[model samples]
Target chain A: MRPVEVGHRGGERAPRSTRLLGRHELPIACEADIVLVRRKARSLAQAYGFDAFATAAITTAASELARNCWVHGGGGAAVVEELYDGTRHGLAMEFRDTGPGIGDVEWALAGGHSTTRSLGLGLSGSRRLVDEFALETARGEGTTVRIVKWKRF
Target chain B: MSPIPILRIGTTLLCSVHVELDDALAERLQEDVLGTIERTGATGLVVDISGLETVDSYVARILADTGRMARLMGADTVLAGMRPEVAATLVRMGFPLEGVRAALDLDHGLALLAHGRSGATEGRRPGRTAP
Candidate 1:
């Protein structure tokens, strides 16, 4: 998929930033994919001067989301993007799955909640780890979770 | 990978696992431990967990499965020398260690086993000489 410009204002006075940042897509296959996603997220975050803790958190969050995709969704893909203005800025990730969508988003976001016998900290912990988190799901359609973390450096 | 050392003293077998007990190692541990129980006719087995850094769900499940498999083979399995952090993680993750024993170290575990075996034998035959 092509990267679309978002967060643009509808005014002629505002200058339009046309810089395209890095984008990556990876397939979630098995439990090992979780670790791979974490590593990839860490590298992307570190490349943008994000603090070590922030990078570690992003890595853990990515691992959680990727694991959910593998275990619950059967398989999915992850998209990562780095955004910048001047000094290294922020990173965002989108995880999309074709598995059965969540029936209760609110309940699922609560900590220690899980349908399977997992640690039940996937979505909740991931949400807490990032600066911004959003989820969209439709019954039988699919689920998409988006998260963004800003650089502390 | 080096084979986990197994020491058989009478009816009990002491196993020293010198590796991480993560998902990958858990698979190998299950196979090796279960296979040992089947072949050696051990009545009890002790698994050393001092080398593990963490116990995730997969490894926890493997430990539980190993216990069940040992029982099926007529052997009881106990976990020994779990690091405090690993124990805390397992507890937080709600992995039950019902039939497994957690000891502070290998020496302590061996001593406990020795005491239990001697006590059991003394109870069985009061006048017999202690081996």
Candidate 2:
């Protein structure tokens, strides 16, 4: 059996940006992977000169989204990309999975409603931690969440 | 793998989290802590998290639950040594540290625990010098 894949596939264009400084791909198959994702995001953000608060925020967002992929999505892939678009620098991450998709996007994003008895802050809190947030999912297909945090001058 | 060590000091237990914990490790730490409390009959737990870089919702939940569970077992819990940025992120995420006392550092945490142990119904200790 072939392993599931995510992020930018062949024929799918990369993110619209003038230059991508760095890119990394990681597979999220277990709880340890979530910790790795956070570390990867933190190092990348620090390398890109993110402030301490921004770095913490980025890493927290990565941890939350990666956990979603592992817990709700039943494992997936994460792609972290550093972006430089003319005047601004940014870090973007995409968490994708081929597992059962979320049935109610609204309810999931509402916060405090969880299937795993958690605080249910993963989706809602992650959205607030980043500068840009986008989620795409189909009930029977899969779910993909993308988030970006921009470096401030 | 060895479980996170919980050191006993007098009637208190000190558990310092030095690494980022996944769910399994966090659960293990929880069980170890509770079991230690049961065996030692400790009345206070000080969880030092200065080594942790980030306290996400999951880690935050584990800390909160540990505090609550310790309370149920007749123990007071003090969360110590949180980084400033981590604290800011936690507040922004709106995940409050429920039922746990917050201290600036390990010394303050220990002092608070000591105060709680000695002063069940007494007023503040005058000319109090940190132990």
Highest-scoring model, TM-score:
2
Chain B TM-score of all predictions, in order? Answer: 0.75, 0.87
lDDT of 2 by residue, B38-90 (tens): 99999999999998888899888988899899989999998889999899898
Candidate 1 root-mean-square deviation in Å: 9.8
lDDT of 2 by residue, A75-147 (tens): 9999999888777788889999987888878788878887885699998888778777778888767899988
- Specify the highest-lDDT model's number: 2
RMSD of each: 9.8, 5.9
Candidate 2 CA-lDDT value = 0.84
Which one is best on DockQ? 2
Report how far residue A99 has shifted in candidate 1, in Å.
2.2
lDDT of 2 at B75: 92
